[model samples]
Target: MGQVPDLPIRNFEVAGQGPAPPVILVRSMHNLLNDAAQRALRYLDELDARSVAPSAEAVAGLSRFQEPLPETSMEPRDVLALLDQIGSPATVATAGSRFFGFVTGGVLPATLAANWLAAAWDQNASMVVLSPVGAALEDVVLAWLRQLFHLPAGSGGALVTGGTMANFTGIAAARHALLNGVGWDVEAQGLFGAPPITVIVGEEVHVSMLKALGLAGLGRERVVRVPADSQGRMRADKLPKLAGPTLICTQAGNVNSGAFDPVGEICARAHEAGAWVHVDGAFGLWAAAARERKHLVEGVELADSWATDCHKWLNVPHDSGIALVRDEQHLVGAIRSTAAYLVHGEQREPHHHTPEASRRARGIEVWAALRSLGRSGLEDMIERTCRHASRFAQGLRAAGYEILNNVVLNQVLVSFGDDETTRRVIAAIQQDGTCWCGGTVWHGRAVMRISVSSWATRDEDVDRSLAAMIRCARSLGVVKNNS
Candidate 1:
């Protein structure tokens, strides 16, 4: 095909007559930073007193950002002022004590402060040469995480954006190891004409797992589907007959019911049949860190690879996930990139272990999270949130409502009568704005999910949210007189 005709370039817009920003680095930087910090502290300080959800007027004020790009740069302090004034009002208080819409945690004070400091450092984190501290912190934290999760001493991992990328990274390594066993260099030759690898998953597998499989060029629908039990756990007995180049994907935590698959049983059976088992633990993986909750993930250590989110139960911050593999070489083999100009030092390059090269120093915040919490503090956070979930279930059941799940972890699924009534009650609760909890469909019926994943969520916050939920249900006729 011939090329299309060329078009004329548009003329540049006229520049505004305004003062240019300062070119020199000066002590005034601290003034701008102090102003921004004060604004952020004020916003956070008001979270408990204000409504959890933004008001309609606050959301509508987002239109202030719709104007055309400025021809001249505004002062940094002025820009920060506009952001705090207009942007802060429209944000959902996920960082507060009452946001239960998802299985994600509020940032710990240490991690949040580390994030701010790391942003100022502006480390690329691609290689040890570029950011030695960043790479060193990754090595140290990966070790700490391995011990925390009770993984094998030899296991290693890399940080990613979230659970989806974590799953993709682990699954990609599994693909590489499994396909390479039969003399197929899948990475070098591509999947074309490669050996067919059998993939298996349960009925209640999260969509993120399917997305990860699809991203790895493994057909999402091509895998065999196993049946799950009433609690949304994969029945190990129902696993299909395993044969040649097989990969079995298991869930450590069910998104809705908070039920964990029989990972130990499945691993034993899969290993006997010469198949690889991978766990998509996401948030539930953190249960291993709590002494009382470790039994829930008994066989989790036996998996070939695992994916989890530090942002969820670990209470670090948003967009922090990890992909750990028993053999570090497998992960490096799947994701490592090489270039003549790139620096290859004696130290392990952070980029070699994950799917990105040019990323922020995420490991810094994670290091701060672990260092500040230590072992006991983390365990306390996990156990405390789980107890809060049980409290929610108890309060709702006492009000003549149904508690669908067993309340095993930090998740609770409550059904306020029929599907229509459940949906209506959920809407009214959102409007009430006392707390934020999202709705989900569980096993076939509509239900609301209360995920107490944040370190900020206290016993009193749970009590307040429970009261609001019951009141909302009573308003919608789902409950009579809240009795």
Candidate 2:
């Protein structure tokens, strides 16, 4: 390696003005970051006292961002001040305990701090040479994930943005493995003349998996749909006869019902028919880490590949997904890039297993989360969230509402009454601002979907949110006073 020389700094002064020296940007960045940290801490501290949903006034203030771009650079501190003034109030408090919408998890303090540090480091985690720390952290994180999920010892994994990309990455590996089995080089020749691969999915399969299929050159609507039971579990026996180049996608957790398919039976049948099995575990995959709920994901390790989102259950920041393949070569073959300038090391190169050459260092936060929450801590969070979910279901049912799904996991679906009433209650709850929950149509009936995925959620938070929900329903005249 050659030694690099330092560049000379040029100083500029206005005509007839005093001498002006070169300015150091580092001090300004430090002050800006310090201000940002203080503002963020203040916001987090106020989450418990503030409304989970943004206020009307705060929402109306969003027009402040519509201003035209400035021709000149503004002071960083002033920019940060403006963002906090306008943007902070308008944001939904999804990181709060009462936020039960969209299966989003609050950030673990350790992971949040790690994200900040990683941002400061700004490492492109494509290869070991690019960022030794990032690559090493990724290796450790992948191992921890494998052991936590009870996946195969040698399984290769990649950290992605979220569940969708995770699904895409895993399915891409499946595509490569199935195509290679029949002497077709999918990477080299593409899917042009490649043998048509059959994709099997449950009737209630999530849209993300279908999007992954479409991205992989497999038509989304072309999959063989196996019917699901009333509880949303895929009927394993209803699966069609499997044939050549087949890929079976199974769900570990249903979006609405929080039910698991008979993955043991499905995996057995798929493997017997020489098919590959991929699991879209998403939030539900964390159940395997909890001793009480591990049975929900029984036999998931048998799947050829699995995709999961750390942001959902691991309580990490947004955009952390894992793609795991039982065989390393399959994932590498599907996503690896080759370039003469690229350096290959003895250690793992993350870009070889993932879909992108340049990506954020998501594994750093994953490693921080795992380190902060050991096996027992992780299990406790999962179990506690499920317990809160069950409480919601019990409270809603006791209030003369219909509890639609079995509270097997951290999802509760409640139907207030008819579709119209249910929609009204949902709208009212959103407007009430005591807490936030989303609406979903489950089994052809309008229902409120509450996902208790945050570690911040407590029993008191659940009780408070439940009280608000009942009040909203009662005000709508849906729940009788007697009931």
Candidate 3:
């Protein structure tokens, strides 16, 4: 690193009276973008070949970016150069096929391209007047998602940051609708003196759903926790007597076991009691696309509200979530606001349906991904990921490991032996880094959680990852070297 360089002064005038059109930025921007794209392409090209986790040296190299703020602005090209050289290597290859530490969906090619293009456009999606394309894409993707998820025919939704926010938005709508039914407008009058709303959740309800409940002013601990069966499905028989203004939160997929709750049963029970039902599908809601997995979440469309993440199962770039409500008015009533400067047109304003006032048009990448991968392509992707998960379970179980969960969907939990040995095996597998899997406590046992979540994953990738896992376990004396 050397002395920071000062940027040259740039001035631009009105359209007819400018001294000269600024060409320096145009030239520099072209060069910088080209450089960035090339570097990105190279990173993606080498993604699978490298370790899923970054090397220690690369992590140590991040110290280079910790310098004090510069007194003078550096050239854009120099800034990008420093970032690309230093930042790229330290990233975990979640975009690659083998990284499975979380429910991370690898960005598809079309979605990646759309993300870059959307960034360049830099449109605020708060209002349709700001970006017609953004609002239009949001409208399109919402319908496509509702249909694909088997949601209500005319349900409305918002494209938010991710699953947490998606859950927040959906739960907010449930609060509004339920409170309104009891002649108390929670959104308008606040929850201070409102009717007490009864909230119910499954025993294995996702943390995000609880966070959403708290955010919506429904006390997380105040909810009735329904008991769950062995596979983490909410026991429909265990649901408390539904009474008063109630909101029942069901799970589409259990985070640990990937099992689904009896959503249809809960929906029936709640509807009979005039209670609103919400589902936190997160990644499992995508199972609707495949007939094989669809049976797991049968009658999902009957729910009053649903929330999911595009970044998890749709293979889109991160931080995209979809929140859908069967009744459009409830979603709009709960999330919309009026401001003099906010000129909302006839078209659906993206912000009104979400929590944020200003947000990037996430629907652009979602639209691009769905358009590129049509009905058959999406179905194939989900089915393929489940098949890969089954393969992992088979390989690990065949090698004398105890699988903690039923191989139902794209999530598998395996134990190497006892808790200590399982922990050691997990640590060793991560250190070996042929592929990446996370650890979780399932059924009071420590187990390695493997989530097959990317379209890039194939038979060969699963085989290679399985081999690495068994090799690491064997090296740790957790598995016999019989294979």
Candidate 4:
């Protein structure tokens, strides 16, 4: 009773008068996007005018996630202020012409705009009825992607979270088919006390594959590790004679040097042994679409299932990956679920092809990205990235750095002087912020891993990065000491 006497109530007559209608929300979003686009264009103009790299603190801060918010709405101006408070790192610049960091992509206008629309619509792409336009876009995008990779007709495609999930879906399908061949209903019974299935993979396989194995109930350490060449390509001739239900995991592109395994031979050996072949092509699979690099993935079409990322080579924004299976039944059998209450009817459902129930409209961005670039434009992007990688390797080699691995696709691995020098150069390069590259232990030596993949990158950017690398190497006393 102590201070509750002044509580006032609104009249029922004023209850129906709302501040704004739902249509205003839509209009507000449209206006916000238009304003953002105009601002971004102006910022881009300014960024392109500058030659020096921005401060590391400034660039790296962009990745910081904002604080958790209360379950409430704020004023639009307040939200904009929050966005301005956050700073992003140079990774977005890695998508720009000047950055040569990990494989990253600039936001293509069409993809960016489509993603905005997708969020606005907030469509769940689990089934056609959930969002007919999203479902249809996925269908068209999958068809075009299949054709681009030269995959055979009738192959099933799924838009997943990213390459890891893509690999998971592809391997799941492979597991289903391989285990089913031996009379094991994995999906029904789970991996508890099931017949052990053999999984053979190249030593150079990406870490995501191992993660996928764990997720699929196939033990990572249990898989047979095949030997790889100096360039990290799997030795197809060394395929161990195998019996029983088995799965052969091959690489379409080595994550280190972008080298591809002997897909034809590997597929033939797996087929001969009655094993399922799954290719983890996260970025390399798209090389087949580029005429110049198509030979790198010569035998990719023979793969039983494959995984690739739109955010990587395809240059779509984050969180877009595709999994393709040669057999539709295998994909459906692997991921489909049943529930009496939520009957999906006798129609093709998106959930059956993916390991998701209520998923986002990821295909909209992919469709927009592909349609914006078209086939030729995409091939050009791949070819140009490869060329830039070669340029980087050549430039580094000329500057006295030990170029490791063959400049096969778009990955270039190099070392300066000995292990210590290489480590120092990598640290200096990162701290210097002229460009950003990653480090990896390759062939017992720590080396710099440079991946060229942005659509915005050009010859000048490659040259500038190479020059910066040379300067760092020289300053570390490595070039003269080695000479």
Which candidate wins on TM-score?
3
What digit string (tens of lDDT, one per residue) describes model 4 on residues 123-171?
A: 9999888888888898899999999999998899999988899999999
Clashing pairs in 3: none
Candidates' lDDT values, in order? 0.89, 0.91, 0.89, 0.82
- Please provide TM-scores, in order, for all candidate models, with all chains considered together: 0.94, 0.95, 0.96, 0.90
Q: Kindly list the per-residue Cα lDDT of model 3 for residues 1-483, writing each as its tens digit.
A: 232233343565568897556665555566667777888999999997898888899999999999998888876777878988888889999999998777889999999999999999998988898889999999899889888887777898899999999999999999889999989888879999998999999989899988888888897799899989999999999998988999989888888889999888888889999999999999999999898888988978899999999999999998899999999899999999988988967777777788898899999999999999998999999999999999999998889888888989999999998999999999888888789999989878999999989989989999999999999999988754376
Please give the TM-score that candidate 1 achieves against the real structure: 0.94
TM-score of 4: 0.90
Q: Where does the lowest 10-residue lDDT sum fall in candidate 2?
A: 1-10
Best by lDDT: 2
lDDT of 1 at 28: 49
- Looking at model 2, how many pairs of residues clash? 0
Q: Pairing residues by index, what is the TM-score of model 2? A: 0.95
Which of 3 and 4 is the better model by lDDT? 3
Runs of candidate 1 with Cα error greater than 4 angstroms are 1-24, 480-483
